[model samples]
Target: METLANLESFVRSAEQGGFSGAARRLGLTPAAISRNVAMLERNLGIRLFHRSTRKLTLTEDGERFLTAIRDNLEGLQAAIAEAGGERREPAGVLKVSLSPTFGTDHILPLLPDFLKSYPGIQIDWQFDNRQVDLVAEGFDAAIGGGFELSPGIVSRVLAPAHIIAVASPAYVAGRTLPLDPAGLGELDGIVMRSDRTGRIRQWMMRNAAGEEMAAAPKETIVVNDPAAMCRAALLGLGVTLIAVPDVLPHLESGALIRLVPKWYADAGPISVYYASRTLLPAKTRVFIDFVADHFKRQRLAERFAGSLG
Candidate 1:
């Protein structure tokens, strides 16, 4: 009898044409996949793959072995699933990436309920602001706005990524409220500078009536991060434009107030993205549905829509 892990690893590596892809699909490390293949090869006393620096090629024996096992692999897996009760219960580490503040503020709260519902599934959340290569990085899913829709990747939109001007109530208490975006030039601006491009970010505010105008405020304080900009505004430094999701709690708590409430800038939709496959792994599939359900139940689509103007 052959070890199931060794057999599965060999078959998956052959099908995927690389250990990395097989590892990603199996939720194992690439080194682990390679070790399993090596073990299988040693057991059979045959070199299954002609490994190279760039890619692996199937040896003659490898091709024959694949033909022998390809049709039976799924059946074997299903049999094992039945024995282990995995068919009914999804179990695995669900690796995901998301922005730090958003993940902490929104997604982290769902963990307790998620863990209770799926005890077998472990959460491995990576908080980051940069766009990551989902497939190459082997991430099960990612949540953010402005991700480039590369091939094989699909997005499930959660909310509108609309930017609205905001300021702490203390900062605006005595200051004359900007009647229009043009009047923003009169106030000190705690503006965002793009870290990647080294450029000051700017937005043309638009209202429900379709009126548009420049929103350049006096560049009093410059920061490269959204969280920092929010902090600056909270400290009564000046008003800053920000996404509604990041500042929703403060707004509700009366710590922050919406400025130029009628005007907003469309930044795009924040979406949950994952690889598009015919049969997604059980853990990944369940997680995707769970997030979508939460977003719908919370009415986040409506609450995060700053561009409703």
Candidate 2:
């Protein structure tokens, strides 16, 4: 195989019309450029140039080799330029993995703006409820709810995810509302199957005395998707423990009512994680900034629910 360095030197010499000219352009001595070209010619078993003191001429073999490799050489240059140009602007493909519910609520709605702003970029998205291997999957970033993030990845706290228990007003009709966390066992509920915890999720609550506790209602329905569970609660199927943003609209519309007041569980921060911070790609950086600004301006959990109301 032809060495890239030698091929580069040979191409430069041919384009510049002489070894000294190629050397000057490449920041190498003329002797070094000549050596590179000679090495390339010997490796390829072809005499690339017919040379004299006055002028240089390409041999037939040289012309054919140049024609074949010119495009490849130019492609290499363009790639190098793009990689180095990241400091100035965003470019290239960006892969992001996220929970389907969070992506639908927060990122998907604002995606058009991101695409419009950076027309040169492309994206690959993976939306799943299961934890994914971000690095192995080549994901530039991941957006997830809850506090614990996989080690070895960089993460940022983008927003607080509020966990609350809510049910349709019809479900509460003719029934005394659960006055205490212990009373929750008498009510029916839709629960999320937590992949991380490997069990059916229990509603988290705080009592009037400020004690945090988990309540698993005796009458419960298990489901995976938060949006689906919220919808079920709206239809008076059962109480659903969901993110505040997911149920905001129902609360306003008087369709769903918050079961616990301010004592609802605080699930901690919603985080946006990426592979590394040392050198973030342009597309990933732009999306991160956009997400941070979006949650700050709209308060994700509130705006969507407010819309329903």
Candidate 3:
């Protein structure tokens, strides 16, 4: 019986059309690949390829053998993948990056429960305001908002985020509230830089009559940090455009009021992304599954609350 390791090298070399290419793909030296294939041939008592200085061609027997080997090999690979997907005892380090505000508002608050469930998985969490290259940083996952996602990465939308225009109670005390999105031009705006480019954020709003438009002040005070912008708005600096969850506390406390209640919009989706590589490490798969289930339960609760209202 031939060892699977030797058979794998032979199949790789045949599929890659050359030993060097297969070696590169398998992260092995060309000499090592040749040795493995030679060993496979010796064990099987057959030549799998017609070799030359400039070319390597599969023999008739090699072609037929390779076809059968290919199927078996693929089956073996799928079996391994399925086995690895079982994250019941995920035990390893899981590194993740997330937006600072979202991390503080959502992820941090729910982390204790996650730790309780999977005590085997250790987390190295980093809060970042800027976009991070997960592959380069060696992060297992990332949580972010936006419709656009990086290529070669798998993404699952956690929730539909709501963006609202809000201002402090003090700012609205003597001011005329905007009944429509068009009236936003008459108010002082505090623009927060929530995106990577540091541009002043604009409000996408719709009036009670359902007329929609994007609004921003001619003169705007731009702030980089969402927390700082929230603080400024709460202190009555100006009306700010922010995600609802970030300002939910202030809304409940009567510290801030919606400037244009009818103008709230769904700010696309908040997603958790990870590399789409075929083989996922145990810890990463565990966290992804848990996070998805957690958000599903949260959405269900939200639906119940909305029904009660």
Candidate 4:
């Protein structure tokens, strides 16, 4: 009879295309993967892979066997995990990715209580602004806005990622307030250059009266990071459009003021993303519920809407 280790090695090697790649994914050495596959082939009396120095390709029998087992692989793993007591307690490392500013400002504050409640679970969190491949990179969950959802990934909207024009009180003190988007070009503009596109980003602003216009300010300073743009505004360098959540505290503290109170850009929904599975691990399941509840209890959806007068 073939063992689970042999089957897993075969499947992972087939998916990864090489023993070395499978080793990385399964946390086993290439020799172990090779040995397991060899043992399985010996047991079955058939070669499953066409082994080579350059790449590993499946044999005819291997392709058929993979088709039969691939659909059930995740379910089999879940069943094993449940039998090993994952369903009873969240006791494994939970890997998550999040944006630096939002995670620090909002999600980081909730960790104390979450950790207190689920002490058995360890958090491995990465802060980044780039869209990550959740399944390929092995992230348990991710949080941010404007992620393109691939197959087998799910997302729950946490809040509206709305952008609004903000400036330090001193910056706007001597300048005339912009009554419309067209008037914004007269003020010194602090803007962001896209790291991916290398072009200055523009904002499409909408007012409360259902009027829309493109606000492309004359750039005085260009930045790549959201936090740095806010800092530049704080130093009274120029007016900048920023996410409402990023500047909410400053606006409330009177450090930053909304230039056009009714105008905002609807970027998209800030979301919590995870792999779509019928049986979610307890750690991932609890974290999702906790974050959703936190947003609701704090009224972050409304506050971060950029509609506050």
lDDT of each: 0.88, 0.74, 0.74, 0.89
Best by TM-score: 4
Per-residue lDDT tens digits of candidate 2, residues 116-149?
A: 9887778788888866666545567888865346
Could you tell me which 10 consecutive residues in candidate 2 have the lowest summed lDDT?
300-309
Query: Which ranges in model 2 have alpha carbons more than 4 Å from their true place?
Result: 1-88, 195-198, 207-209, 301-309
Number of clashes recorded per candidate: 0, 3, 0, 0
User: Residue 273 CA error for candidate 2 (Å)?
Assistant: 0.3
- Model 4 clashing residue pairs (backbone): none
Candidate 1: residue 68 lDDT (0-100): 95
CA shift at 134, candidate 4, in angstroms?
2.5
How well does model 2 score by local distance difference test?
0.74
TM-scores of all models? 0.82, 0.66, 0.70, 0.87
lDDT: which is higher, 2 or 4? 4
Q: Order candidates by TM-score, high to low.
A: 4, 1, 3, 2
RMSD in angstroms between candidate 1 and the native structure over all alpha carbons: 3.8
Query: Candidates 1 and 2: which is better by TM-score?
Result: 1
Query: Candidate 2: deviation at residue 282, Å?
Result: 0.9
Which residue pairs in model 2 clash with each other?
245-301, 248-305, 249-305
lDDT tens digits by residue: candidate 1, 133-184: 8877889899999999987789999989899899988888888999998988
Rank by lDDT, highest first.
4, 1, 3, 2
Which regions of candidate 1 deviate over 4 angstroms? 1-17, 31-50, 57-87
